[model samples]
Target: MFSKILIANRGEIACRVIRTARKLGVRTVAVYSDADAHALHVEMADEAVHIGPSPVGESYLRGDKIIAAALATGAEAIHPGYGFLSENPDFVDQVVAAGLTFIGPSATSIRAMGLKDAAKRLMEKAGVPVVPGYHGEAQEIVLLASKAREIGYPVLIKARAGGGGKGMRKVEHPDDFSEALSGARREAKAAFGDDRVLVEKYVDKPRHIEVQVFGDNFGNAVHLYERDCSAQRRHQKVIEEAPAPGMTPELRKAMTDAAVKAAKAISYSGAGTIEFIVDASQGLKPDRFWFMEMNTRLQVEHPVTEMVTGTDLVEWQLRVASGEKLPKTQAEITLSGHAFEARIYAEDAAKGFLPATGTLYHLKFPDTVPEGATMRVETGVRAGDAISPYYDPMIAKLVVHAKDRPLALQALVAALRQTEVAGSTVNAAFLAALAADPDFSKGDVDTGLIGRHQQALTEIAPPNADIVAAAALAASGAGALPPSNDPWSSLAGYQHFHPAARRTRLHYGEHDITAKVSVRPDGRFAVTLDEPYGSTNAHDLRAAPRLARWPGHVTVFSGAVGYTFAVPDPLARADESAASSGSLRAPMPGLVKLVRVTPGETVTKGQPLLILEAMKMEHTIAAPHDGVIAEIATEGAQVTDGTVLVRFAEDVHA
Candidate 1:
């Protein structure tokens, strides 16, 4: 094995690579930008190198800087961990030119599968089952639309380049085709610099099952079963599981064999995934699976595969890169128990899953069930790290494995509920709810599952009276005894004849709950709702509420959800009328990518008015009912959160 390897990525994947390298007794080097100067990965590595500024173009995407840093630090190889430059063929070529090993597939293999259209053509020629779609070179709008029509209605327009659901649109009718095409093309161009798209028939109730395949330089390849990543939101996989729930012996064999064939077709080496879209409308049949795309790098959901197969994928990558033969032959590998992985992201599930940025005040996960494979918390951030907008907002990947699918799923739900995060918005509660969902629990899952049940998944209900009382008690320091030697200071709410109730108010997202506390003789306290926001009575405190209090904010994890309350100052009052100026503010900090309307331009309700690009996604700002744009922000301007992007001529309510 190589003595030293440089990880050419950031966040969890980089930290993940470092852990494996350390296990192999290999010294690892980490490269960071300005945003990740004090990142967890940097602290974990044997040596750290500062490449450039925070912007990816200046730092992570600069192949030259990365190569130079690797050479300067005497790293014998570079591990491009999944994102930034993982699939960039040019970067792989440059690393090889520098006389260092690239711990992944060859540049030729990457180029072969770089474009979706070209890859589909190659898969077809290789005798691999491929979805019937337009994989031609035509880029004309008219030609593409004609191809969509020929493919039939409800077609999917996808960017030929890039992944992560960007530059992809699903049109259910012919009338919406043109607008969907234009939007997909625009996003594709912005994301990948390639507006070329391929039209494909949209499969109904498709289950995303991807086989984990590995190859060595000796032309040996093997499969590690499969992972069902059907639970998704916005085309992104939210929950993934190994040994697909409804998979049969014949179907698994067929799919795994096809995956190995696909990998061998490109002479693939190292760790790669061959993703297949399975038509589950009827059931899992051998003929129902078709090639979707091949990710030419280690996948984010590889842990579940590792847990089920008892194989270390990163170790395989390193061994193959070191010119070692395949670890095990196809016949030698065996599948064991089922496993599941849930991606924990710092995003708000209610507000359209918008990526959130904040400092993590606390982070915790639950332990696995007894005699089960330990629940793993794969993350890159610590308690005090800042989640910046310069990169992906993923907080961690929670993986659980058990004897059966039901047990594994039960563990997943428990782990999600026990996982706690504060100082930022998260989808933890949503994840728990999804795991416990009747449809999901029965394994009737697909890419459209989240969308079909979006309201239930994203709906944020106010905290109950008990939860509010808990927050109030924690915030007021009523439950815990005072940290003082003097008895008088500790005598809070204690009266000579009777204990007096102390009132404290807390606000949770516009709803106010006032908690009244009565201290007991033994320092224990009873808190009741002085003003209940929800239609429920607040009972007396059973025990001290579990809480984490930061300045101005208190996060209390009650039941399945964690509720955050703002400890408002009793002396300060706000002017509601002054805060209601008619303006459309940027929901988050981002660059104004487009201004679709000019000042005084009349726009109907729900009309696209402008676009903001942030966290690698485009958010459209639409007109609020019938209104005329009185003021417009310039395109390409960098705006902070709540910066007015557009102002209306008259009051919106008026």
Candidate 2:
């Protein structure tokens, strides 16, 4: 094995690679941008180097800088952890040219599957099923529209160089095809610097099932079963699992076979994933699955495959890259149990799951593997670490393994509830609710499930009144009072020296909860409050001194009623006009990549006018109405959330 290697990435993936490298006694080097100088990945590596500024183009995407760092650190190999430069064929070639081993597929294989168009052609040649689409390299808009027409309505406009959902759109009718294509092309240009696109038939109720394939230079390859990545928001996968729900033995065998064939055809080496969009309308058949795109590196959801196959893929990557033969064959691999992985992101699910940034004040996960919960939290962040916008907002990955899917789902929900993450707008409660969802538990999930149940998923999860009262009483700086207290110190009503009941108001979103807390003669709290369900008694507090430190909690006391209420922070909000408008605005902090329209340009509703690169993905600022551009406030400039980019002028008509 190589003595030392450079990880050409940052964040959790970089740390993940470092851990594996350490186990092999390989010294590791980490490259970071200016913004990540103190990042966890940097601190974890044996040595660290500063590449460039925070912008990925100047740092992570700079192949020469990364290569120099590797060479300077005397790294014998380089591992391009997914995203950034992982699938960039040119970068792989440069790394190999630098006289160091690239710990992944050869530059040739990456190129074969680098572009969606070429990859589809290659898959077809290998006899692997591919989506029926027009991937021809034709740039004429009219011709592309004709191809969409040929493919049928409800066609998808996707960037030939697409991943993470950027530069993709689903058009339901011919009339919407032109606008969608234009938007997708512009986004593709801004994101990948390639305006070329492809038209594909949209499969309804599509479930994303991808097979993990590994190979060695000796032309040997094996499939590590499959993972279902259908649960997504905005086309970005949020949850993933292995041994797909409802996947029969026959279907698994067929999918695995197709994946192996694709790998063998490419003479693929190292780790790669062959993703398929399985059509559920006609049931999962060998013929019903179509190739989506190939991820030419270790996937973010690789943990699920690891749990089921009982193998560490990173170890295999290192072994193969070091001129070793395949460690195992297709027949040797086996699946043991079901697994689920939810990508817990530092995002506001209530605000359309928009990326959020904050310090992770207190992060704790259950230590014990519960009755039904087998928890594995892989993270590089700590309590004091900040979720910066210069990178992906992923806080941690919570994976669970159980004997069956039901057990896994049940365990996952309970585990999420037990997770306590403070100081950020994490989607823990939302993820917990999703696990408890009846449809999700029964395996009725899709790409649109979150969107459909968005309201319920984002309803701010607040502690019960009793819990709030307990916290409040503790925060009141009052340890359990003595049974008998002096009249001056006692907060109870007396005959002559009577103390009126104290009321503390706490805000929970829009409503204020007032807790009438008073000390009883027996040294316990009594709390009374009116909830939506009418007047109720809530006094769930244990007599403990530690409870007295809850600063913002509201302790309530009524006749034999006592409870603790948590105070919600009103400062945590996206500052913007509450009223809806037809103008386009920036949804987060990002650099404007492009502005497609000029003043007086006519735009239909949902037309993309500009693109923003933030949190490691491209987001388009869309037009909300069919009108001419009134003004443009931003063009290739940095902006924050709610910063208006463009407004539409009233439409002119005959």
Candidate 3:
């Protein structure tokens, strides 16, 4: 193996590669942009180099800068972790030209599988079953629409150049085909710089099962097994598991054989994944599965595969790149147990899964595990790290393993419940709900599971009296006081007549609440909450809810849910009336991609007015109610969070 290698990526994947390299006594170099100067990956690497500015185009996407950094650091090879330059064929050629080993497949192999349409055609020639679709080169709108009609209604338009649910759309009818195609093309161009798309038949009940395959330069390849990524939202994988549920021996053999065939067809070397879209309306059968696309690098969910198979894929990549033969034959690699991986992202599931950006005031994960189970957290962030708009908002990946699927899933749910985060919104509760979902527990999952039950899954119960009292105690600084030995200090609130009480004001959601707190002689707290409904609830507690206090906010974690309350300043003026104003503000910092409605144009509630691109995704700003647009932000405008994008005109009477 090479003595040193350069990781040409950022975030958890980069950090993950570094850990494996360290295990083999290989020195690792990390490259970072301005946004990630003090990132955890940088701190963990043996050496670090600054590439460019924070934007991807200026830094992570700059192949020349990355190559230069690798050469300067004397790195013998470059490891492109997952995203950014990982799948770019040109970058692979550049790395080879620089006389540095690229720890992945060759440029020819990537090119063969880069474009979805071309890859599908190649698979068909190789005798691998592919989805029936329009894989032709024609780009005209009329021709594409005709092809969609030929394929039948409810077709999917997917970008030929990329994956991860970007630049993809599903059209239910001919009437919506044009609009969907336009949106897909625009997003594709923005994401992959290629607007070319292919029309495919949409499977009603689809399960995304991808086989993990590895190949060596000696023309030897083997399958590690499969992962089921059916639990998804917005066409992105949310939870993934290895040794797919209900996978029969015959079905597994067929899928793995086909996957190995696809890999060897291109003389593929290193790690790659062959993703198949399974038509599960029936059941798992050999003929019901079709090739969707190929990912030419290590996958984000590779940990689940590693946990179950007891192998390190990164070490395999290193050994293969060093001109080693296959470490073990197909039979030597054995599957032992089940594993599940849940991706924790800095997003708000309550508000349509909007990406959130903020400093992490407090961050934590489960430190204890149940017997016969193992828990691992793969993350590149620390407690004080900031989640900015310049990169993906993924927080971490929580992986759990056990002897069986039921115990593994039980451990996963418990781990999620113990995880805590503050300063920004997260989807912990949503993930916990998804893991504990009845259908999910029963293994009845498909790509449409999250979409079908989104409303119920995103529902979070309001804080009960106990949670409110905890927050009130934290906000009042009463929870931080130490136990007193003196009777005078403990009896300070004792009065000659009635007990002394202090009121604290806090804001929860949209309502302002007043908490009346009184200190008892027994060192307990008596809290009375005044509700907006003209009701009062009282609670006496010896212990406060588990909470973390920041400057102006306190977060109380109850099970998988976290309730954050704002400590209001008593001297500040009240401005709650503006909550009803008909103004649409940007939820996060992003660039305005398109403006669909002009000033003075009438729009109904939920009508798309503009689109904001942020965190590598597009968010559509819609009208809050039926009204006439009075003021609006223009296209190509860079906006920050809370920036008003559109305002409605006041109603006038003649």
Q: Which order, best to worst by TM-score?
A: 3, 1, 2
* Model 1 lDDT per residue over 291-376, tens place: 98999999999999999999989999999999999989988889889999999888889989888888899777776454555688
lDDT of 3 by residue, 1-654 (tens): 999999999999999999999999999999999999999999999999999999999999999999999999999999999989999999999999999999999999999999999999999988889988898999999999999999998999999999999999999999999989988998888889999999999999999999999999999999999999999988899899998998988889989999999999999999999999999898898889999999999999999999999999999999999999988899899998999999999899988899899899999999976789999999999899999899989999999999989999998999999999998899999999999999999898999999989999999988877788888877876556654543345434556655567688888898788887666556555677876323222234433467789878999998788899999877888676555366888999999999999999999999999999887678889887899988899999999999989878873221
Residue ranges of candidate 2 with Cα displaced over 4 Å: 460-464, 467-505, 512-518, 526-587, 592-613, 616-632, 641-654
Model 2 per-residue lDDT tens digits across residues 262-341: 99888999999999998887667776898888888999999999988889999999999999988888889999889999
Sorting all predicted structures by lDDT, with the top scorer first, yields 3, 1, 2
**Candidate 3 versus the native: TM-score?**
0.96
Top candidate (lDDT):
3
Badly placed stretches (over 4 Å) of model 3 are 483-500, 532-544, 574-580, 651-654
Which candidate gets the maximum TM-score versus the true structure?
Answer: 3
The worst-scoring run of ten residues by lDDT in candidate 2 lies at 555-564
